[model samples]
Target: MYTLAVCAEMVFRDLPIEERARRLHDAGFQVEIWDWTRHDLAALERTGAVFSSMTGYIRGSLTDEDDAAELLRTAEESVKAAALLGCPRLNLHGTGLDGRGLPVDPVAGEATGPMWIAAHRTLGRVAELGESAGVVFTLENLNTAVDHPGVPFAKAADTLALVAAVNRPGLKMNLDLYHAQIGEGNLIELVRRAHGLGLIGEIQVADVPGRCEPGTGEIAYPAVARALADLGYDGTVAMEAWASGDDDLALDRFRTAFTV
Candidate 1:
């Protein structure tokens, strides 16, 4: 009942990215990626894979004045990269994440009032960029308690607040359930709340604890799938987790989990 995609960055690790894209394509799924700059865009374009989304900027923060400007500049460049792959939704974060997936300069505990204010202003400008470029930008949530400790606006609730505050058609929430299950417990209600507002551009998923494929951990994805279907949410639900075992089998489980 929804478009399915798998993150190439998380799956099929042994193959080249182009091949990974092709593999997902051949397996009847669109592909998602992180950091378009690291790949040869020409090769990716040649893979004939329908891309769902990619990281929207190279380096910048939503809460910094200078970095916000850099975010806008680099985001414009990211739009060009997305064009090559026909990716319609570009992903964003509160700040630039390092190679280790840690925030460049984290906001310990809570961000200052000025930081939130700056983020709002920066995201407003980011929405303008998305509007003019004809691409939607999705601000993703991360769990500070686990994978991404100390990142500002890392909670799903905080992200929802910011995206709702911006309230632009060009900007929307990525609404990752994996992170949400860690940071916030109510998946069905969160989906309902975000969907009810028309604020969700995509829903990313993985089972909790291990960050592995569905059915390999604690999340009841089939129920989540049914909830999305019940809400008439027909947008993308992408797998953004590593395989627990054989990659193909992992893909199979992911498909079955969402097979409502």
Candidate 2:
């Protein structure tokens, strides 16, 4: 079976981090965060909620040779923070080309083949660092069409390929269903393919169109949840979506839809 974890940053925007963790824990859910740098680790521990994962590093481009050192440095710091918060996994985004936040090649105006090579080498080193720290690194696929425009690893296939090229035990994929649905329609197939290859280490969910609770959009989250369970996926399925109504109701819908 799969457990549900809510993205505290997105769902509980107004509340303090400690209160957010408390409420989610009280409601029998785990919590995930974008960053653990500012949160009270002790208070979160007291809530008895699992810190599923946190973003590994932001702002640095994994595909840029010049930014490789900085990226690795930030990732090292993230591993330490994850250890402190009792989180075993870290999520990373392919920031931009050349660490300049330009998204695409400034001259070619699109992603080039050489970028992938640099990304593979840089991520391999970061994963090596994570392996010694007992932390796993997940490269998350974002939707360049909407949520994350210009992100290099927006496609599920590309992210999967990157992880495969790295071929590190500490490296894996953070498959976000919402982004996958937007960027590519074959959600279940992608999940099955990635799981079969043992590339998927973490999962996140949000319905398409509105990016809200499962039932609030076009994607059938219940079927997706069942597919995950059937595939023997035991990782946390984080609700990384916006709330449409009562937070409790939104979470209730998520729990009911993914109870398998």
Candidate 3:
């Protein structure tokens, strides 16, 4: 069966982390946290909710030298935090071009060859640390056109190439389908390619036009879910969308759509 992990940070923002964990556990879903530092580890543990994945300690440009160094350090700290929380995966993003540590317009001076090389070097080091800590690091792709304008690594192919270049056993791709749909429309093809290469570490979903529940958008999530199942993707498929109405109802639709 496909495992589902809900982004508590987005879905249950009003509730305490502990309460979110308990509610998710009761609702039969795993939890994905964006920032582990904001949560109470002990409280999360008490609920016994499985932590599907979390954002990396540092969320900035891996292309810049100074930021890359800080990213490595943050990764080491994140490894310790993951161990403490019993989480196995950490997700990362390529902040922007030139390491300004913020999302930059992709149109304004795209990432160059040197930036790619720097990313490989930085991620390679982080992957090494993750390997020893029993944690895997996943580089995620964001949509630069709308939600995350100017961020680098917005394409699945480019991010996967980075993972391949890093060539670390602990580093893989976190394919967020919503962003992929906006940035690149060929979702199924990308998923197939990533799965065939064993590059996909995790998957997150929403729909286009609005980052809301699946059925409310144009993306056919049921088909996507079935495709993933056909590819034998056993990793967590996280629900990282906004709910328009009843939260529980939104979750029910998510489960129904993806439960292959």
Among all candidates shown, the one with the greatest lDDT: 1
lDDT of 2 by residue, 158-254 (tens): 8999998888989999999899999898999999999999998888999989889889999988888889988989878899988887888898998
Candidate that would win on TM-score:
1
Error of 3 at 180 (Å): 0.2
Q: List residue ranges in candidate 2 displaced over 4 A.
A: 96-109
Greater-TM-score candidate between 2 and 3:
3
lDDT score for residue 161 of model 2: 93
- The deviation in Å at residue 171 for candidate 2 is 0.6
TM-score for each predicted model, relative to the true structure = 0.99, 0.92, 0.94
> What is candidate 3's lDDT per residue for 1-260, written digit by digit as tens?
56898988767657887887788878999988877777778788888888889877654467778877877887787887887778889989886333332464243557788888888888888888888888899999887777776676668878999998888888999999998998888899999999898888999998777888788889999999889989888888999988867888888989988977
Residue 181 shift from truth in candidate 3, angstroms: 0.1
Q: Mark the regions of model 1 whose C-alpha exceeds 4 Å error after superposition.
A: none
- Report, for every candidate in turn, its global Cα lDDT versus the true structure: 0.94, 0.82, 0.82
* Model 1 alpha-carbon miss at residue 105, Å: 1.7
Clash counts for all predictions: 0, 0, 2
Q: Report model 1's TM-score to 2 decimal places.
A: 0.99
TM-score rank order: 1, 3, 2
Error of 1 at 195 (Å): 0.3
Better of 1 and 3 by lDDT: 1
